[model samples]
Target: MIIEQSHFLFVSLYIFAISIGGLLLNRRNIIILLISIELMLLAINLQFVIFSVFLDDIIGQINALLILTVAAAESAIGLALLVVYYRIKGTISINKINLLHG
Candidate 1:
C-alpha cells in the first residue's frame, strides 16, 4: 500500500512539474517545451511500468514501448518544424514565430 501510494505521489509530482513547465516556458523557450513533453512522456512510461509490475503483465511494457516510439516521432516532427521556423524567422524563440497565418 505504501509503495503504491509513493508511486502515485511520484507520478503526480512529475505530471504537475511537466504541466507547470509547459505553461510557464511555452512562450519563453522551445527547448523547455521539448523537455516538458519528455517529462510528460516519462511519467506515462513510469505509470505503465508500475502497473505492469503490479499486475504481472507484459502488455504494459509493450504499451510503454509504443509510447516511446510515438514520443520519438513527435520529437522529430517538432524539431523539424522548429528548424523550418528558424530558417524563416532566424530564431528559435517560440514567442517570435507567430506567423502561421497561411
Candidate 2:
C-alpha cells in the first residue's frame, strides 16, 4: 500500500476543518475549545511533516517541532488558567470569562 502526498493532504485538511468547526460551534465548553485548538495545531503539524517528507527538506519538520513546542506551552498555560478560574467560580462553564478581573 503506497501512500501519496494527496492522501496526507486530505487527512490534514479534514482534521483542520473539523477542529475549526468544533472551535466555532462549541461556545459553552472551554475544554472542547481547548481540544479543538490542539487538534488544529496537530493538523498543521501533520501538514508540515507531509510537506517536509514530500520535498525532502528538513526545515518544515523543524518548524513543525517549534509549533508543537508552542502548542504544548499554550495548552499548559490555558489549563492552568482554567484551573484558577474554576477554583474561583466553582464552574468551568464559559458563561463569563474575565480571568484578570476575577
Candidate 3:
C-alpha cells in the first residue's frame, strides 16, 4: 500500500472539517470545544509531517514539534482553568461561564 500526498491532504481536510463542526455545534460543552481545538491542531501537525516527508525537509518536523509543545501547554492551561471554574461555579457549561463577574 502506497500513501500519496492526496491521501494526507484528504485526511487532513476531513479532520479539519470535523473539528470545525465540533467547535461550532458543540458550543455548550467546554470540554468538547477544547477537544475540537486539539483535533484542529492535530490536523495541522499531520499536514506538517506529510509535507516534510514528501519534501525531505527537517524544518517541518521542527515546526510540528513546536506546535505540539504549544498544544500541550494550551491544553494543560485550559484544563486547569476549567477545573478552577468548575470548582468555583460547580458547572462546566460554557453558557454559564459569563456569570463570573470578575
Candidate 4:
C-alpha cells in the first residue's frame, strides 16, 4: 500500500473543514475555540509537510517547525489569559467576556 499526494491533500481538507466547523459551531466555549485554532494550525502544518515532501524541499519543513513553535507560544499565552479570566469571572464563556470592559 502506497500513499499519494492526493490522499494527503484530502486528509488536510478534512482537517481544515473540521477545524472550521469547530470554530463556528461553538461560540461560547473558550477552550473549544482554542482547540479549533490548534486544529487549524495542525492542518496547515500538514499541508506544509505534504508540499515539502512532494517538492523535495526542506524549507517547508523548516517553516512548519517555526509555525509549531509559534503555535506553542500562542497556546501558552492563551491558556494563561484564560486562567486569569476564569479567576476573575469564574467562567470561560466568550459571551461573558464583556465584563472586562471598563
Give the per-residue lDDT digits (tens) of candidate 4, residues 1-102.
Answer: 899999999999999999999999989898999999999999999999999999999999999999999999999999999999889889888787897689
Give candidate 3 misplaced runs (Cα > 4 Å): 99-102
> Least lDDT summed over 10 consecutive residues: which range in candidate 1?
1-10
For candidate 3, give the lDDT.
0.94
Candidate 3: tens digits of C-alpha lDDT, residues 1-102: 898799989999999999999998887998999999999999999999999999999898999999999999999999999999899989998777787568
Location of the lowest summed lDDT over 10 successive residues in candidate 2: 93-102
RMSD of each: 2.7, 1.8, 1.4, 1.2
Per-residue C-alpha lDDT of model 2 across residues 1-102, encoded as one tens digit per residue? 998999999999999999999999999999999999999999999999999999999999999999999999999999998898789888888777655565
Model 1, stretches more than 4 Å misplaced? 1-12, 15-19
How does each model score on TM-score? 0.78, 0.92, 0.93, 0.94
- Candidate 4 regions exceeding 4 Å error are 100-102
State the displacement of the C-alpha of residue 21, model 3, in Å, after optimal TM-score superposition: 0.5
Give the C-alpha lDDT of model 2: 0.94
User: Residue 14 in candidate 4 has what lDDT?
Assistant: 97
| TM-score of model 3 (CA atoms) | 0.93
**How many clashing pairs does model 2 include?**
0
Candidate 1 displacement at residue 67 in angstroms: 0.5
Model 4, position 86, has a per-residue lDDT of 87
* Residue-wise C-alpha lDDT for candidate 1, range 25-97, written one tens digit per residue: 5777887878787878878887887778888999989999999999999999999998988898899885676
